[model samples]
Target: MYNKTIITIIRGALGMTDCKRLMEERRSVNFFDAAQPLTPELLRQIVELASLAPSAFNLQPWRLIAVRSPEGRERLWRLAQQQPKVLEAPVTLIVVGDRGAWQGDNPAWGELAAMLGGAEAVKPYLAMAEALYGATTERRIKFAESNAALLAMSVVYAARCFGVEGHFMSGIDFAGIKQAFALDEDEEVVMLLALGYAEGGKVLYPRRKRQSYDELVEEV
Candidate 1:
């Protein structure tokens, strides 16, 4: 028999183990099991989980439009240099991000300011938001794009956790994809994810040698 505290710790450890196992096992599978089609429920769940990813001031800029029709997939395949994986993959996801996600009402910052220094402190924070999100410049564009990229990666990871293989792709004609999908001009595709089961036992190609950790890391 195990003690209560030990049992609780064991449960927590098992949860962490499950998460870590999925992370370690996930791979970028290029070939997919063509027999199965990705379901709406699964797509919804994956997006919901991914929305929890950290964003700048909780601006949650990422949006996903899933292409399920064979015809739509065919069009996407053509846009992606006629990649067979785009056609064979059960689900084709177009990930978009709004460049102005932070311009709207920002309650999180106001709340935090109030918490840290009370109501009077929030006035400056509001001005800061106006300056940062209102002025559209190269620096701000890059900032939003960086956060959107992280959120996109989180979507791939979340899908993999649900036993769905993920392939992050950006090799498509951006204008064609937008026109074909009738996407709004304000929202732009940041990435694409091909989701399905792996075609064979192998989930991915073998890892290539990477730069040394020492060379990549700096303590400046």
Candidate 2:
């Protein structure tokens, strides 16, 4: 298990106000300043921060294809229903989820073993992951997509922390993306994230109304 004290300390440094502001300010930017491309170093930093997102058995199943090159972006734009944001954003990430990440060969298994004491300590976890995520083809896909979605949300928030904006787009050519990107059979495309500086550092429209907490929550 993770150290609660350490987690609390990190949260304290982040502060509740900062967290609230990030949640409130983040928007799906439709217009990106194409002239201001994301630097490789900045992109790396954002991804590294996003990777801290939690996952089942810590078997980080996510993969990303950063489409920054002109050719890559153009190809992705075509595969993504030609969304203008795909071409306008400085970088677009093809988020993929590996359904086979629960396998024993995954490096996360070894890392978890080391954290828990020894390789023997990971046996139960391995069995649990297999039983939960490997039951059927649909289950495997669910495991991958669910975990990748968490990482995708983290990427959006992490980018916002650095003054970068992001948009999550599911309108895509799934089969074409898989074929064009040459993904493995077990790798499922989760979504695409377009990231860049928003045009004029603002959104064209005001924030839309969201469901109230009372309307969304349920007491069971």
Candidate 3:
């Protein structure tokens, strides 16, 4: 069950006006307040909120390694191209995607089946997942990466609701991270997220120009 305090906090922070303001003001913070500490309880709450992100067949396949200790962050810093934020942020999350989550034997399938009605009701969905994601290696990788990306995005936004800032980093030594972390072969490293308060309570640069809707959108 979701925590009532967390639900209240989210409700207060995510009102229409606040939501729009948060979206516009959010930035990929480059400088983190190293002195400011993030409690494990708060971090867990952020992750719990992020878990609400959607996934195909309700098979949520993402995993996270929260590198919070100074030593752990130092190790992550090396793997992440020596990015200072990896160390400066109170926590860095190694987001992983399970490429084999769609398999029939996955426990999530059984749980989903129970929720839907029964095994019989879930058979078609299982077949569809297999047909869409299991036919080729490329398809399975795409499915994992895409769904994990969705979860990662949610993590960023969820952190913001608690006045935390986050930066997404993809320029990392993926192979080294996998080996160092001892990840399973089926787990794909999606991205790294640095989470903490911004140094001096704000970002350094003004918001950059974004493409206009007309340039970015197409009416088919």
Better of 2 and 3 by lDDT: 2
| Tens digit of per-residue lDDT, candidate 2, span 30-101 | 999989989999999999999999999889998999999999999999999999999999999999999999
lDDT of 1 by residue, 146-208 (tens): 777887788888888788888888988988888888877666777788988888774466866
**Clash pairs for candidate 3:** none
- Which residue pairs does candidate 1 place in steric collision? none
Ranking by lDDT: 2, 3, 1
lDDT of 3 by residue, 1-220 (tens): 1132243343333477887967987899999999999999999999999999999877887899999888999998999999999989999999999899898888888987777678987788789989998889999999899999999999999999999999999999999999888889999889999999999956478878999999999989
Predicted structure 2, TM vs. truth = 0.92
The C-alpha local distance difference test score for the whole of candidate 2 amounts to 0.92
Whole-structure CA lDDT of model 3: 0.90
- Give me the runs in candidate 3 sitting further than 4 Å from their true place: 1-14, 201-203
Alpha-carbon shift of residue 101 in model 1 (angstroms): 1.7
For every model shown, what is its TM-score relative to the native structure? 0.79, 0.92, 0.90
Question: TM-score winner among the candidates?
Answer: 2
The number of clashing residue pairs in each candidate reads: 0, 0, 0
Alpha carbon lDDT of each predicted model: 0.76, 0.92, 0.90
Better of 1 and 2 by TM-score: 2
State which candidate has the highest lDDT: 2
